[model samples]
Target: MEPSKSSDDKQVAPPRRVSFKYRSGPAALRCLSDGLVYFAKPSEFNDCLEAKFDHSSVADYIERMDRSIRSVSEQRSCAGGYAVPEGDLASFEAKTACDDVNFLEATQRVGIYSTASRPDNQPMWTYYSDNSKGFCFELEWPDTVLGRYQIAPVGVLYSSAARVHNRADIFDTLIREEAELHPDWSMDQILEETRSEFFRFRFQMLNTCRAVSIKHSDWSHEHEVRFVTPRAGPLPIMGQILKRVYFVRTDFPEWGPVMMLLHQLYPTVELAKMSFQHVEPYVRVQGMTKKLVPVHE
Candidate 1:
């Protein structure tokens, strides 16, 4: 009744412990009452149905869930500490909340918003390093938009699932609105346009940040989500600037399964590594340096 060994009969190392700070002791974290994914059973989604979702029921369910989330919302998280997509929304041109915007419009608006708001200069920063155990992008926010914004990192159980749910909620509402905007397009056309990950990533990156703070990166935030472009030293795998992002912070584990999850989430795009574990600063002394330069933390 024992486990197997490696090819060399050597012990394999267990995965590194995720660096997220521990919270209150175990009491099963309530999510959909029993770890449901996206507020409904997985079986609830069907691509072929005439009307796949019960919009009203889902809204009611989300309301109840929102109330519950608010109760625990004050808890801290790995969030980079900025205004996130879900929070910074102003009234879209459509004005009408739901069933007035479609996938294309939704994607296009964020694009416009992000491009319009980008700042000329951003603060230079290395990697994730914070004495308080928080990992946030350092940026020079314009005086008009800069302000103290706190964040609540997401819980482990709901990190990935919540994103799907959250994004889906935004998408579905837009789809319903699209029903209004594109009165002539068939559901098949609608579904096909919205299903591609390209649009999803385009829309996603456009979101995640209200104010642009990174120098060369596409996304930005004091605490929400920002990344470094390959020009600013992002991994080479991430393609052309503004299209693919390298790193971001959320209310979830930094070094946990998120790295893997992100890889799967955006197949073509590259995600910069952000480990949950604290990284020590490398030592460099004046004696060790031969050139004229200054290095400080």
Candidate 2:
């Protein structure tokens, strides 16, 4: 769905990017076998703060509620529509406040996110890839694959501290247009009609980015990128999105069958084994060495 037109919309040039997903052997096998990648909910994430943000605070909710009500009221008065009187606005704000918070919380729980990282992040392998006992998939964003699956990767924004987004103007234009279109309806009715649109635009706003793409700066080492969808489930992979597979240790006992299955299923994908080498004088930095080896039948 196209993002609603608003000042909050940001125009970003799409960059050519690739990402890597580290998975255990069984999980990788399941992904390849079913041709479906599981998009998990934030509640399933290891981080307790996974989709939490200051945008969900009561202060932000009240501000957004006030703006939406005022915008609708003004639009109706200007367009000669059914306008809500100023006195009744206090009651309207109180009622909509609950709806705003409820909808935001519901959307947060329903949204599903998938994550990947820069290929060279060793810690990602340790934490996510079963500590070198599993493997990683290198994914490229080919137009065909991304367009088919609707997978637009957003690079995570890492912040050193908490942020407060008091974005009261989020749904102003959209609600105004809706009021103009349905001039006969009361503000309550108009708002009810546009409830989904309001929350949808709110989540897509630049400040929030759907409440999933921002992370704490402490996690900057992962260099994470994420793909998000409102619906949570197995999304089938239809095109050549999987470019390569990196085995953390080919010597692992379970790799024999997993390799055979991978070769049988995705014969054209490049397979490689990853190892780390330490260079003297650069003690803090470790270089990843990969040997590209074809999977044999």
Candidate 3:
């Protein structure tokens, strides 16, 4: 009735722990997330999926599961922010009038409006990073135009999801290419170069933009969506630049399994569970609302 020595030894062995460390650069993180298991990173996502499902019919199951998850609306009002008033004829008309007058172009327009009307006291820069040395891009959707939106720089962190094949080479290529593009450079050359490429690519993507709008009778909403492209065209060059310094994760097949694990690890991680299957991999989450809300607490 006594247990064998082999069984006793097996029972005494410790269970392996899955540990993930944060990377310093964006490209490094992207590589790690893209199924490259170097440096103690999790790799072999397909194997992980197989282990989880215990079946070969992962494709069909995934397709069905994705559809179901996508069906669930992740829309919620941004935290500490009021919904921009809708259906107010007077306020709508006033905003239209203000926009029509090119008020933003005038030097004293915001000041003039502040004196004449109540200013919106909402914190405009919720996720500003002083280190980034640039501003986040804000895209405002127009209610009248089903899927129309305007893109503008807000404070200092722009949201994007771009994939790159190689990190170091790409970064070097971009720096050299940008430098050649702008010969007259000085101390602020690096900052200007990066920003120029970012905006240029962004506009290119915008030009070929296709709107991914969602609508519901329960809650109606629509917004324009586009990838931030490189100025050189729909090429990977700009994507590399963005991936190097910015926080972005490339769309990879392995991402599905990795995300599934992350979801299981933290069930209350909102929007983190949502997979960008066929569409652009990047979807901006409101900075204030990304905090994990505990299900039990």
Question: Which of the two candidates, 1 or 3, achieves a greater lDDT against the reference?
Answer: 1
Candidate 1 lDDT tens digits, 1-297: 111132333778654211111111111011111321111111232212211222233344345434433322223221111122454344332232453234223222221111112111122112222221222211222222211211111111111111222333344444555455676765555556666776565335333221122121222231222221211111221111112222223334443333333244334432232333334533211111012246798
lDDT, candidate 2, at 126:
87
CA lDDT for candidate 2 = 0.64
Candidate 2 is scored at a TM of 0.63
C-alpha TM-score for every candidate: 0.20, 0.63, 0.14
Model 1: residues >4 Å from true position, as ranges? 1-62, 65-104, 112-138, 145-158, 162-224, 227-297
Q: Order of all candidates by lDDT, from best down to worst?
A: 2, 1, 3
Q: CA lDDT of 175 in candidate 1?
A: 50
Q: For residue 101, give model 1's deviation from the true position in Å.
A: 3.7
As for candidate 3, its clashing pairs are 135-155, 135-156, 136-156, 201-229, 201-230, 201-231
Q: Which prediction has more favorable lDDT, 1 or 2?
A: 2
Two-way TM-score contest, 2 vs 3, winner:
2
TM-score of 3: 0.14
Please give the lDDT score for candidate 3: 0.26
RMSD of each candidate relative to the true structure: 22.8, 10.6, 27.2
**Tens digit of lDDT per residue, candidate 3, span 204-236?**
332222111111222111111222111111121
